[model samples]
Target chain A: MHDFFFYLFSALTVLTALLVVLCPNAVNSAVFMIVSFVGTAALFLLLDAFFLAILQVLVYAGAVMVLFLFIIMLLDVERSSRVRPDVVTVVAASVAVLLLAFGMGYLFLTGHDATAATMAAVPQVPGGANPMEYATASRAFGYGLFTKYMLPFQVAGFLLLVAMVGVIVLSKRLTGSNEAGKPSAQEIRESEVSQS
Target chain B: MNHSELLTQLSEQYVSTNQWCALWPEIALALLAVLVLLIDLFAGRLRARAVPFAAIAGQVVIFAVLLGKLGTCDPADSGLLFSGMILPTTLSEVMRLFFLLASILVCWLGMLYLRKQDLPRMEFYCLTLIVTAALMLLGQSSNFVMLFVALETVTIGFYILVSYGRNSIFSLEGGLKYLVLGGTSTAILLFGIVLLYGAAGDPSLPVHSGDSLNFLALEQFLAANPNNVLAKVGMVLVLCGVCFKIGAVPFQIWIPDVYQGAPTPVTAFLAVSSKAAGFIVLINLVTGPFGPMASLTVPLLSAITVVTILFGNLTALGQRNVKRVMGLSGIAHAGYLLLGIVALIQGVELAAWAVIFYLFTYLFGSFTVFGVMSHLAGPDDENQEVDHYVNLARRQPFLAGVLAIGLGSLAGIPPLAGFIGKVFLFVVAFQANLYLLLGVAILGVVISIYYYFGWMREAFFQEQTWPEGKEEQLAPIKVCLPHKVAMAALAIITVLLGIYQGGFGGGF
Candidate 1:
């Protein structure tokens, strides 16, 4: 059953992800991306990383997709084929994709052996009903985070705060009157250059 | 020890003592950032005058703590804090001092530049403090998790600071490029970390293997498994990511545009503090985790050094913009600094000291040029072109003199601090038998002189051409009080350090 579900989700993931790129319209691409994200989340769920699976859905599929859609709408993106795809770009991209696939294949082959060795090496908890028990899973995460990884956790807060400030500051627009009051120093420099 | 045993031991180590005192500076700065935000939001523009002062005052407090810790903490006393995450060694202490001093200078520069630019002022100070705290955190990170988080915090802060001049297209473009490239490099770095984690494997079963993400543990693992192919790949990828941050060759396409477009103060901060942080982390990784693998990294670093030096200096030769020149020159400096890292790998004891000394001199020299640029620039004008500075000495002697000293140091002229720093690095490289790299570095310095002198010549030698009737409109540049003081301070430090070199010697 697990094997069946894994194949199902993987197939769906690849299908939707392909659609996300191949779709001509911006809105259709965005919709396909959500489906792709959901497929990814399902795969995560199968891996027993339940927290990550839920976050993948809640953040990427829900909030982030909405933001993407908003941007697409605000920009009024059209599906015009103004410029033909260049052969050089296409060739370069294909080579890059092939290289990436080769690298990933090598990584996974070596990584699988390492992971097996690691799993065998880890000392299981005493009196374990199941060594991989999901009980206290989030608790385990919190314990490690608060204790050994406290500094990183706090730094993450500062990172988010900076992002917030950046977004607010960048999105702000100056009042029309403020812009019209006088020529800015830059304008003056340009005018001087032109006059000269 | 088993995984549980390791956790228990680390927890006991953390909970036993008040190790939190060692992190007082970072904590205070974090709180100061929050306070600045609150003040900015609540007080609005009414209390604008108080914000920068508060930021400067917080930096002063941090600086005081750094000074107090200097020469006081014995090497043996310096150890891990917050479990195994932080190693606040004396090395970190000195590096933190540099960060603080740089931050304080940035605040002064930002304040003057902000007022002139008429941009939002409060968040500039707040973010600078946050980034400084992050720098402190980065200097002390002994674990990969701490390193990544602290690095991200600094990068995020800079992304905002880079585009702070929101109205400028150049600023926005620079910020976007930095963000996209920085994000990609970060992903590459994380991938490398994951591979290393896999190669190290689980430490819990206690076959005496290293932990997944701890620097010390990784070092032990690398020493034990010298031929681990996966670990080698991981280390290479990690170096690539860091090279992006340091603006080394092959990862340097972003530097020129970003440096020229970022608010001049932000450019200075990025040029000094950001580059310093990258080098510090690189030193930590190369010396700590990859020490035993010097056989692997030495050749890699040598190739990078040669390319970075040749590429930076040669490309800079054709640049018309002053900021672009500084940006490319910074890349060349990174090459020189990398030579020191090679020396470190070759078992030279003074290599790290040489790097620190070089960075210290770089701070004063680069900031001298940046501070003058900040003062001369108006709200919408960068005044960054080489032509903009023609006959600047006739119009503003102080600014011109500061620029000359700054560029002179950068060009590695004798009797300046930069020259001394370069000599020390080259000596260490020579001691390590890196004659080829030393020769390359000397060539880079020579190439750099032509442009540096070009800038000086434009400022002092060229006649100020005011088109026919426009001569009456041109007025002498009026520098603000804070900028004046800051420029003067940097000039004095550069000259005095060049003459004395006492403090640098004693610190080692």
Candidate 2:
């Protein structure tokens, strides 16, 4: 059953990811990207990484997708015109795809037995505790994050703060008369009228 | 073990690993950034003047303190802190100082840039401070997680900075292009990190590691399995991501447009500090976890160096825009620096020092040129043409002299700091037996002189032919007192470093 569900979600992920790239409309591409993220979350669930799976959904699918959709709407991006691939581009892409397919095939065929043997050799957990139990618990992630990963956590906060400041700097309109040396909106309008 | 005992053990681990004292400079930088933001909030009318002064003053103080504490802060004595997340060696200490110096100059340039354009000034300083702090951390990071987080902070800071002149369509266009490209590179870097983690964490491997993201453990794993295909692919992908940052060929498509469009100070920041950060990270990887994979890296980097040198110089030859010329020539410099990396990989230990020296010379020369560019730039910052510099020597000889020295140094002319830097790198490359790469680099230098001197010609030798009513546009550029002092200091350093190598010149 685990194998069955893994294959199902893996297929869902690859298919939707392809659609995300193939979709001409920017909005549709973003929607397909969300579906791809959900499929990845489901695959993580199959691995019994319950905490990661939930975070994946909450962060990438929920929050990040909302931002993508918002930007798409704000920009009012039209359906992108799909340019026809020239002969050279088509040939080059075909060669790349063929090489990739060949490489994957070669690796799987020769390495299958080695992979099985390595899996058998994996060391068991101490005291025979279920590995999934430790990884799946939300508290385990919290402990790791607060303890070992404290520096990155703090830096990520600063990253978000910078993003916020940057958004305002890029988009904010200075309109007040109090702004030193800067032309107010009224002054700017008058200057424009004079120039015209 | 009892539940209470386990809890106590965990707390003990946390207490032992969290060495906050080692991170004082980074912490102080973050605080300074916040203080700048707060000052902007409350300073009201004086905010513009107050914020830059505070930011630059704070950075100068931190730089002094870090320099004083340099000898005592070596990781050789203290070992890795934060459970091997940060490894502060003598090199990282120097990088911290380098980044602070760059940030201070960038803020000063930002003040000059903001005077003409009506833009929000405070955020620029705040972001520069935060990004500098992150770059210092990036140089010291011993874990992939730390590296990624710090790198993202720097990249995001640059994205906002690149487009800070939001009123200009060119700035916005450059920002979007950088956004798309930078995001793609980050994804590639993340994917590579994930692959390495997966490969190293495989319990079936001969020497598997539980903490696969740590550089030391990953090094051990890689050393044990020198022929691991997965790890090799991961290493290449990681290098590709870094190459994008340093603007190597095939990944340098964004350099010309972005440099031409970004505010001059931001472009200077990207060219000097950002590129320096990328090289430091590359050096760390090649000499650390990727050390064992020298068989794969040396040949790969050699090929890239060849193409990057020839391509950068050839493309730069025909460029008329000064910014585009700087961007392309900077690529050729990256190629020269890559020679140092290749030498380091081939067992020349002193090659790393050579790379750092070259970066220092680059910073001095590039900033001097950028300082002049900022002074000469009109209201439309993006459209600085080479023709604008005609007869600059007659009009403003001080600025013209500084521009000549800066461009001459960048061209690796004799009796300039850039010449000494190239000599050291070539010596190291020769020691490593990279004869072909050395030849290509020399050829690249010869080719670069044409363009660098072309700009010089426009400034010093070209005759001015003003069109009707164009004399106002070509009026003598006024250089303020502070700017003159700064540019003079930079130019003097370029000449002084060329003549005297100080401590950095001893070993080479």
Top-DockQ structure, candidate number: 2
Per-prediction DockQ comes to 0.31, 0.41
Residue-wise C-alpha lDDT for candidate 1, range B55-92, written one tens digit per residue:
89878977986798688757447455666678876677
**C-alpha lDDT of all candidate models, in order:** 0.83, 0.88
**Model 2, position B54: C-alpha lDDT score:** 97
lDDT of 1 by residue, A71-157 (tens): 999879789475667999899889989987887677556643443443454355554434444223565566667766666887898
lDDT of 2 by residue, B1-508 (tens): 3333444456468658779888889999999999999999999999878999999999999999988887774467776588889888788888999999999999999989988887777899999999999999999998999999999999999999998877666777788899999999999999889989998888888788989999999999999987666776678788989999999886898999999889999999999999999999999899899999998898889999999999999999999888889999999999999999999999999999999999999999999999999999877789998988888898899999999999989999899999999999999999999999999999999999999998999999987677776766565688889889999999999999999998878887
Q: Give the true-contact fraction for every prediction, in order.
A: 0.39, 0.45
Native-referenced Cα lDDT, model 1: 0.83
- CAPRI band of model 2? acceptable
Cα TM-score of candidate 2: 0.94
Residue A82 of model 2 has an lDDT of: 83
Candidate 1 regions with alpha-carbon error over 4 angstroms: A1-32, A80-122, A126-130, A134-136, A173-196, B1-18, B42-46, B75-78, B202-210, B506-508
Question: Model 1, chain B: what is the TM-score?
Answer: 0.95
Name the docking class for model 1.
acceptable
TM-score of chain B alone in model 2: 0.98
lDDT for residue B177 in candidate 1, whole number 0-100: 90
